[model samples]
Target chain A: MLFVFGHQNPDTDAIASALVYASYLTRTGTPALAYRIGEMNFETPFVLQAAGIEAPPRLPELAEGTAVALVDHNETGQSVSNLAQLNVTHVVDHHKLGDLQTNTPAMLRFEPVGSCGTILLRLYREANLSVEPLEAQLMLSAILSDTLHFRSPTTTEADREAVEFLASVAGIDDVASYAMQMFAAKSDLGDTPAEQILAMDYKEFTFGEGDDAQRWGLGVTETTNPGYVLGRQDELLAAMRRLKDKEGLAGVMLSVVDILEEHNETLVASEQEAAVVLGAFGVQTEASRASLGGMISRKKQLVPALEAYFEQQG
Target chain B: MLFVFGHQNPDTDAIASALVYASYLTRTGTPALAYRIGEMNFETPFVLQAAGIEAPPRLPELAEGTAVALVDHNETGQSVSNLAQLNVTHVVDHHKLGDLQTNTPAMLRFEPVGSCGTILLRLYREANLSVEPLEAQLMLSAILSDTLHFRSPTTTEADREAVEFLASVAGIDDVASYAMQMFAAKSDLGDTPAEQILAMDYKEFTFGEGDDAQRWGLGVTETTNPGYVLGRQDELLAAMRRLKDKEGLAGVMLSVVDILEEHNETLVASEQEAAVVLGAFGVQTEASRASLGGMISRKKQLVPALEAYFEQQG
Candidate 1:
């Protein structure tokens, strides 16, 4: 059986896309099982409950050379620990291409749309397979979560069309109200520890080449109430510093994204990270925070800017 | 304007898929012009002549950051010289994933099929676009040439289905006869220089990482008249040696594929190459040549085996 999964720090899209794609593959005559590499974030539980589905089981320890299918993510740094040892048979992703390779040619479907859910919808249509109600609901939630209800810069016409089609199939009306409710569920962080919050939607990326190459951790917390996240800035920064040391990362930053306003206020763990962020975004760091207006999408806006800055520096 | 093209040392699939995909993009409201980064191989001319379509113009010098779309290939070493500088907005390929990075998200469609033509056929269908006669003819020829008329190990069910559908749309009935004619045309090498033959359908690849990394050049010449090619083994080996020296490659091998027999007999340029091939394929080299039985596919068979051997070596 092929194991289908997504990136670490499982967000709603990461978890939902894996489950939907696994089901699509199974329906198309390939036996596949969905797995999650990391713990689900606050938003994922809400999305799963709304769709009346359970989260996929955590990925078990598979022997090297196991066949796997990747959904919603492709970068090695964001995937399984034994990724290089496994056989990646298929990849359906929406982010920029990264350094993931296979021993042979594989099925890879990627588009510059808002979410992997949009691509999966096209895949189902092309195969002449009807999307089950559960699959449709899961995909609909992923699209809304990833695109922030058509507010993210990553949003495209395909994503909007997919959401409309999926909403009808999912028997969902009042998408705005549903999205707000989802955001509220995500924003109700309660008393979650700072370390868990910092790891909720985090990913690591390598920039530059050779000796100049540096690995940095980037985390984002999207919520309707950004104030709730920013209020615990010191604790988050402390956790970030601990993570940076534990992982030997060059730098780390946690961005508090206001889902309604579609803007970012990032907290830098140290002066080194603050300098890198300032250089990359041209924003001044004040009291360990930088306001990045309208830069809400991490994949579309933030990572690209940081990558470009590092390339220029090199 | 998006300049769509394929890999260097363009083959039938490379040149034809670029033209067909460029047309697909244009029909879908994106202005695109097809170009070829290198000279067309022998079979490509025959395919284009049969389709009564002109070959795409040679790629001209474009400024850095010009938007481009890649088809059939994506590795930087096999692509245009300014691949890293240009903005790659789209890629449709059927090869293993390589080290191609973009600043932002792009439209990437890849499948483990025989040719990019098969993927392009699906793209057209998914978009509800009709395939023109010329496009159908080009894609049909590409599938035939790349899969060696369904005899190549790389051939998949999708490729066969695509050929049947395309042959009907292209108004071509005797596909077997046409494929033979193409092979005959490609085999009519006459007095072409050994260097030119070696350069046609050649690609460079890097294996391993960091201090252990090694770059190698691989070339293939597919023809019905293998005796004719093997008869000039000395000349071909000399050309390969010159290429390795000039390009600073660690090793070089030219595989002469017998189209009818469906086998590969490779000529190693030096003892170093012979050793690598022997270790990788466990085939003894006799007089600078090693017969790789039923191993006609470089992408599917040769490269993967060689990559695995090198990875194990590290």
Candidate 2:
């Protein structure tokens, strides 16, 4: 039996790749169990609905015979421990190398591209796996989510090639319309409970020193398009503060990435962190700032750079 | 010589697709000039930098011997005179069909998708174009932007498919990471001018019955994660009023498509238009009370319904 594993607090990319990977594995004669760390979020539901696959219920078994594959995130102490109780054997990720990669004996695979969905897309392509339209759509949605719908800097040529290939094979005439609808659906962020908002789309990280062992969970807070973003600015900041306090995070940062500026509206951990680390890289923390405006993707934009800062401190 | 044409004051989908389309055309052995309609925005700069290409200066000879390609919005009778003067041969778009299509006869291609970028990707593939890594990235970015980063309800299986195929070919491994960064980069909306915010990512439409013109624009006033769209309730109504005053429109309208719950936040000309048309179809002005909360796309989600409503009215 094979199992598919993804990071805790899964995003659309994790959900998408996990679903596609499980499908691929199933196609290859493996009854795979797809596992995620936490409960599913709103962003994950559509892909699951589109794929017509039930989320894998928590498994009661993980033994030595179980070969596991990690999608979207690499395996480590911090990685979702779906197979740790059993025995995971392989890791596939598209993010930059994580420190956990050094200690893991699993098939360490990390490619610095945009989405793990793309990684799984390559796997499917390499193995000549047949792609269903819904599965193709799921994989495509994952890529869109991961790459900020393909605006992130980390999205590479391989990502686009996957898009082109998948577009043709799926016989999709126009993807943008479909994707925009999906985005509009996903950004339905109103009247939701704070907890739901917090968990709706989140990424988790274990930062700080060995003794610190602080788990950081940061969720995005967006504003109204332009002028109204000014109105919601204070409310969003307050919400972020509440989340920060509730989570007891080392630093609760929220940014509003303006696609126009190519700069970050930085809400940093401290004035010192912003000045010393983020400022070193030119993230603006001006007083008149609306919010953290220029940081779009939390993974590629914030985590990686913040990881670098902590690494430098280490 | 190939010319990239975009409407004046381009949106994210238009400009980003133009940049990426330029790259696609270049890879297909057609050197393209990324002509700008106006100043670039955050999404454009990020896409340009990520694609490793720069938007070039407009060529004075766009009217002569130019294998002119138009993206996003198309030209109309009211369109800039230069468009009619151009040696235009091809057009790709994602908006509702406009007067420009019937009024003009350049290889008109309008796919009622969310973004024009998705159509451009199709053109590249249809032409058997060889794409570069940066080109793939740009194309994918354009797709995402048009799709509201894939949350919009109008998102099709095809859009997702293209993103996956292009991402893989472009070698974008972790699409989420890149997307997060880009999204984070856009989080700042504090310092943005009100007019700039209004125009930042707005779409305009002009539709008059016979002689007079009834024009309006719809802008996504707010968004966050997965199904929470707090539309700028009052402002959008005001903007519609302003458009009515400025254009002497028979009736101006503004719609906020909540893609998550699959409804619309509409501001129309009269209670006659609203009740006789919108109310019957369940479109309400009470956005916050909208039981249908997930209407996230304007092009695909809102336009068709409006067209149907108008047809029903007739």
User: What's model 2's interface RMSD, roughly to a tenth of an angstrom?
Assistant: 23.8
Which candidate number would show the highest lDDT if scored against the true structure? 1
Give lDDT tens digits, candidate 2, residues B145-186.
656567776677778888888789788888766655554444
- Candidate number with greatest TM-score: 1
**Which candidate number maximizes DockQ?**
1
**Candidate 1 per-residue lDDT over residues B1-314, each given as its tens digit:** 89999999998999999999999999999999999999887888888888888889999998999999999998898899889889999999999888888767889988999999999999999999999989999999899999999999899999999999999999999999999998998888899999999998788888777888899999999999999999999999999999999989998999999999998999999899889988999998999999989889889888888888888888
- Fnat, model 2, is 0.00
Each model's total of backbone clashes = 0, 139
Q: Where does model 1 exceed 4 Å of error?
A: B207-212
Candidate 1 chain B, which ten residues in sequence have the lowest lDDT sum? Answer: B96-105
TM-score of each: 0.96, 0.44
